[model samples]
Target: MPLEQIRPSHIHQYQNFLEKRELSSTTVRIYLTLIKVICLCINNSSYNLYFSMYSYKR
Candidate 1:
């Protein structure tokens, strides 16, 4: 699924799915944190690229 399309509900669903799979709470939290970090990285990179382009055009 596209990162842009991920929603809070989807994350919640993923947590529930992880629980259903009997994964440890710590593992689930780690997974979620990784996902958040990845999303942040993507968002930051996109913002930086846009800013660079805008600055170049100035």
Candidate 2:
């Protein structure tokens, strides 16, 4: 999917995909954290920090 087409649902789907692969919890956490870090690094978006892992997990 293109960057411009990404939505919250897509993120959820990707998370599900990872789970379906039977990855370890540690691996999943690391991948998700990397994504968050990428987002933070890209825009320095203060608003995003307000929504933490709890928000994403659901």
Candidate 3:
């Protein structure tokens, strides 16, 4: 899906969806951190940053 397709309410809805899946706050933070690190590392590289073990799929 495109980011343009996402709405402000979708952010809250995603949080609720994750909560319903029983993910802990620590896990959530870890995921966010991994996302941040991957983004920071991804500067016009062909490499897949998400190949790291810290990366998770929702």
Candidate 4:
């Protein structure tokens, strides 16, 4: 799906999918972190910014 159309539900679903694949917990966390960073970059946020993981609706 397009970035503009991405929602918190999608992220949650992706997390679930990754977990089902038996990825290590740490790896899943890193992937989610990277995803948050990418979303910030896509939104043109400053590199020094921060985001709360819970801000996204599961």
Judged by lDDT, which candidate is best? 1
Candidate with more favorable, higher TM-score: 1 or 4: 4
- Tens digit of lDDT per residue, candidate 3, span 1-58? 6645656586567667777789998876676566556555664244453455457768
lDDT of 1 by residue, 1-48 (tens): 898799999999999999999999999999999888778768898866
Q: For residues 11-52, could you state the per-residue lDDT of candidate 2 as single tens digits?
A: 788789999999998888888888777766556655565655
> What lDDT does the true structure give each of the candidates?
0.87, 0.75, 0.63, 0.85
Task: For candidate 4, report its TM-score.
Answer: 0.73
Candidate 3 residues lying further than 4 Å off, grouped into runs, are: 32-58
Winner by lDDT between candidate 2 and candidate 1: 1
For model 1, the local distance difference test gives 0.87
RMSD of 2: 9.4
Residue 29 lDDT, candidate 2, scale 0-100: 85
Ranking by lDDT: 1, 4, 2, 3
Question: How much is the lDDT of residue 15 in candidate 2?
Answer: 85
Worst 10 residues of 2 by lDDT: 49-58
Indicate the worst ten consecutive residues by lDDT in candidate 1.
49-58
